[model samples]
Target chain A: MTEVTEPAIETVTIDVVLSALADPVRLTFVRALDAAGDWTCGSDVLRETGVTIGKSTLSHHIKVLRDAGLIRTRVDGIRRLVTLRYDEVEQRFPGLLAMLREHGPARARGISSPYTSG
Target chain B: MTEVTEPAIETVTIDVVLSALADPVRLTFVRALDAAGDWTCGSDVLRETGVTIGKSTLSHHIKVLRDAGLIRTRVDGIRRLVTLRYDEVEQRFPGLLAMLREHGPARARGISSPYTSG
Candidate 1:
């Protein structure tokens, strides 16, 4: 099992975090991760969020999220597990996750989502 | 007096807003505007926030913020008055301004601010 590395709570900056989440795909992914506990870099999340993208695109979004310290990804044998650093991010920048939960990407974009519309 | 123009609350997107505020300088400017209310596109805000930048750069940042719908800028005779779209942003994306208020750019960057230190 590989180690999970992310920015420390104290070292996390709002700018980096917001920049990471500025993408619509990443925002959808983060909100999905927030709603659900942990997800794998698989087609399940894609189907769940109704996001149509290739494997490379998903990988890029995952990398961006992890690099920004918003998500934690660790290799578990052959599978890569991903989880949102919800509490830690909230500690560093309060009200951020709560806002994401309350006002999701769908609402922000003025469009309904598969996750919310259902 | 020039008319104030901005993206309507319904048309405002989180990605644009986040992208605009992702810049450290712009984040500082928004926070300053939030705390101090209306400010001008002049030297006073530069002195208040301790951000040293040329007029063109400030104007550029102001344009980005305005284009992102995070702020409303209007011309009052010779002065270009700028104000944070605090309530409008809150209405569009709740908890964002509150988060900025609780975790300012200084705190987000893990630095002490002249405004807060004093």
Candidate 2:
């Protein structure tokens, strides 16, 4: 059996991560990942959101997030599976995710309807 | 006795906050505020960091962070005293601070040397 190659871990600054999250599209992507505790693909993410966006733009957003270390991807056959690196971000930023969760109007009250109402 | 005017509350999205934090200067500002635990003026902050910057640029950076609701200011005599509104951010973005703290490389280990070492 061939050995599976582990993806190289790249160091990203908090500023970069925050910058990646600055875009509305990226924020929505993060929220969706948080809501759905499973790996997702770019096409599926965009389709689920129903947001009209060009392929290049979507690709750009995903790339930004990936570079910031907020999301991790793995090759699954012919598909790329994406998941949030909550542990890594938590280890790097400390209190940032808690602040997001606290400030998240919908999730704060145990309600997950922020997207629909926000 | 006259009543001091309370600063108007402004609504800011997480994306805005993250955008403001994307800047290296702004991130330094936030980290300084976290370290100081008190209201600080723009001049003092700039001086403390010893980072050479023009007045206009510094003003612009401050405005960006203020617009994002990460910091609040009150006019104290002729000086503006600025403080981080951690509580407000916490209320709005639950789990964000915790995440930041957790991920903070230095702070996570119960150390306050992130600035010097990072």
Candidate 3:
């Protein structure tokens, strides 16, 4: 479909992607999205990610991820949906997203697990 | 050796580390420090990284990286020396530092190689 095009992935840098995933709340969003298949709605994202960030902050977070090309969004009816550009990301910097998925939150909280409080 | 104590790696979080690296200037500093082994003087760091960030800004970047526990600093006579806490970091989060060393700068500038312009 000519309605959408995947970014070349080359235009996206690891810094932006990494920084996008660097935040605790954003990582939560990424994790929730990762567990979700393709095309999750904004409301679902909020519910699944369990983020309490204000509406504007949520909007900002979405913008940061979109601006970094880490995700692409589309409108369906009255809802905006998002999906990860993991394939393009993997091509851009191999193992980047996978590492983030597996280790990002553990690393971010400064501990591998909640029970292992630092 | 009662002069300084290394931070317990467990206290460091990946968010701080990732965000610290998410900056271009700081990544350059990290790259320079990674290559520098155990001890590089502050002057050598600025010279080696070729960063034009002013004194206080440089201090701030160093603090960001240091606070993240990615590096350690010590005073030697008239100069302060900086070193990567690679072993500690590796233990805290495996493959994290190595990946950063190999792919950090390339990802930050949004290009893997300077020769390949975006």
Candidate 4:
């Protein structure tokens, strides 16, 4: 399969960021990047999710996140290092990350419970 | 125009929430709701954005946000009260809002600066 060229940097928008994050797989990837704090290859990042994903799909998801400006990637030798662009995204959408922190499981008083629909 | 029925509650997905927030107008609305901490009519909410928006368009956007579980709305008499579902969204997407808060302009040392491309 041919790899699609990444989107132009100029076209990055909030929609792209939200769309990229809408996926559970992609969200997991981002959380891992947040935890790793450095460039991580796709395989290493997906380990925590316990899901087996195809390489192409993973690449696509990364591209989406990159396009949304949620993550930044650099080519180091033959490996691409991915890091969360927390600062950039937070700048664009204020009050978003703080809200997430308040609800983070790590800070929760008990086992992180799923949200209830009332 | 005919109103589309709201999406099934079960079908409400993170993608929908992200997609709703991807828009500038919608984000502004959520911010206002966060500030207000109560239900607000669409017309009142759009005033802060300084954009002239149609009712149908606003309805559509609200539906998107509601479906994403980022917001909860209740009918108060004939008016719909819209409030940010900060807890629910934060629960599902941990560390997101906290990150946003760190970047929020209100907390910024200076005028909230738009994100710069690097």
Q: Predictions ranked by DockQ, top down?
A: 1, 2, 3, 4
Q: Cα miss at A114, model 2 (Å)? A: 11
Per-candidate DockQ values are: 0.50, 0.41, 0.33, 0.20
Give residue B34's error in model 4 in angstroms.
1.1
Best by lDDT: 1
| Residue-by-residue lDDT tens digits, candidate 1, A1-115 | 2576777777766777877887788888898888776655545677777789998989888888887888888787777878888778877777778777766565444345544
Tens-digit lDDT track for model 1 on B1-118? Answer: 3586888887776678887887888888888888776555545677777789999999899889999988887777777888888778888778788877766664444345544432
Give the poorly placed runs of model 4, Cα more than 4 Å off: A1-20, A23-25, A31-39, A43-76, A83-118, B1-16, B86-102, B105-118
Tens-place lDDT per residue, model 2, A3-90, is 2222233456655677877787888787777666668776777766656799899878877888877777777777777887777666
The iRMS of the candidates, in order, is 2.2, 4.2, 2.7, 6.9
TM-score of 2: 0.70
Between candidates 1 and 4, name the one with more favorable lDDT.
1
Better of 2 and 4 by lDDT: 2
Candidate 1, after superposition: displacement of residue A118 in Å?
17
Between candidates 1 and 2, name the one with more favorable lDDT.
1
* Candidate 4 lDDT tens digits, A40-114: 777666654454898898888888787777777777676777776667656566654444343332222442323
Q: Which ranking of candidates, highest TM-score first?
A: 1, 3, 2, 4
Candidate 2: residue B16 Cα off by (Å): 2.3
TM-score of the A-chain for all models: 0.80, 0.73, 0.77, 0.69
- Alpha-carbon runs more than 4 Å astray in model 1: A42-60, A106-118, B106-118
After aligning candidate 1 to the native by TM-score, how far in Å is the CA of B32 from where it should be?
A: 1.7
- Among the numbered candidates, top TM-score falls to 1
lDDT per residue, candidate 3, A4-117, as tens digits? 343557776666777787787787777666757588875667754445767788878887888888888887776678888878766666666666665646534333322211
The local distance difference test score of each candidate is 0.76, 0.67, 0.70, 0.61
